[model samples]
Target: MDMTIDAIDARVVPPVALAYTKALTLPHLASAVRPRFLVLQPNGSLNQANSSDFQHGLESILEQATDGVIVDLLWVGSLDAYGIAALVAGIQRATALGKQMLFQALDAKSRLALEIEWAQQQESSVGAWKHTFSSNLEAFLDNFTHG
Candidate 1:
């Protein structure tokens, strides 16, 4: 995956700026081939105060994305059960829409929090390893786009 967030020229499209929850700092693939994925970087406290924004971002990004999305959970300051539930429900909605939603839990703390929450949900169902995103773009794409 691309580690750097490409800056966008605001004069071009304002909705691109609005797509991000609080920023317009991702993707410059226009010169290159079409981008098949988008990354969602949600930050700050993810409680009742901002879960609505997060969900709105998720929904809007999914509409903008062509293939899939990787939600980076590293910068989140805090998360509650509601935040966790939003993620789970968002992933299910993505699946229903035939789009992939992969959680990019870069650090141990985020990984543990998401895994614990996911484990609780797994008791009632199961899916493949596509739910998680890896640093290796090749392997992650292989796993996420295929079985």
Candidate 2:
């Protein structure tokens, strides 16, 4: 059965047409992998204000993707706990739908933020888990190849 990107999820507002229109305004990052791969490079800080856009962009892209999505943090300068949580939620959402959500090329700061937030989540005994967060895109892709 063929599904439109906007039609993939029923809960989100603004539907496919509006979502696609909004997505066009966001950054279109290059994906090292071809076909069904959606790479998003969010610049500057990823906080509450920007995370909605990031999340929406991710959801919109996921609607259209067949394989999975990749969020490259190479250009992200800072990410807060909320931002990390948002990413975790997005990854969970993707995984629930049987798609991969890969986070790649994390900078030192982003890496630290993810570790700190992840540790906090573990300590609290709750929160989403990512099976695929890597230092590089090649490594992220290699998992599928090796498996």
Candidate 3:
């Protein structure tokens, strides 16, 4: 398994960016070249309309991904309340499906607050998921190489 970090625009939902990144990674996927980790960094202000589209797009992309591929996604930025909710849901769903999800709260205190609230709502169900907080890309790389 290989590893690749997808540093996305902070504002975009992780899923949406995942979809786009997957497209760029199609050749690898088709060849069964499993990547141990995929880090996503959405921009600080991903457009609302794009978020919805990205969710649907990501779902479609996942359908084509190889089973048992461990994906580690990271969201970095200060987002709006609604944006944070969308991101949380996206991450939760990915985790439920066996992806490792991580969130890096840059400087958006309000957005981080909302993320915590949303996480609390799904606490019981999301416990099996792996979550982390950090801005260190090297750490992710280390896991990626080992995996």
Best by TM-score: 1
lDDT of 2 by residue, 76-124 (tens): 7777777887787676678777888877787677667777765775657
Q: Please, what is the TM-score per model?
A: 0.55, 0.54, 0.46
Q: Distance (Å) between predicted and true CA of 7, model 2?
A: 20
Model 2 weakest 10-residue run by lDDT: 1-10
Regions more than 4 Å wrong, model 2: 1-34, 112-147
Clashing pairs in 1: none
What lDDT does each candidate get? 0.61, 0.61, 0.47
Least accurate stretch of 10 residues (summed lDDT) in model 3? Answer: 1-10
lDDT of 3 at 48: 66
Score residue 12 of candidate 1 by CA lDDT: 38
TM-score of 1: 0.55
By TM-score, the better pick of 1 and 2 is 1
What are the RMSDs of all candidates, in order?
12.3, 13.9, 14.4
- In model 3, the Cα lDDT at residue 70 comes to 26
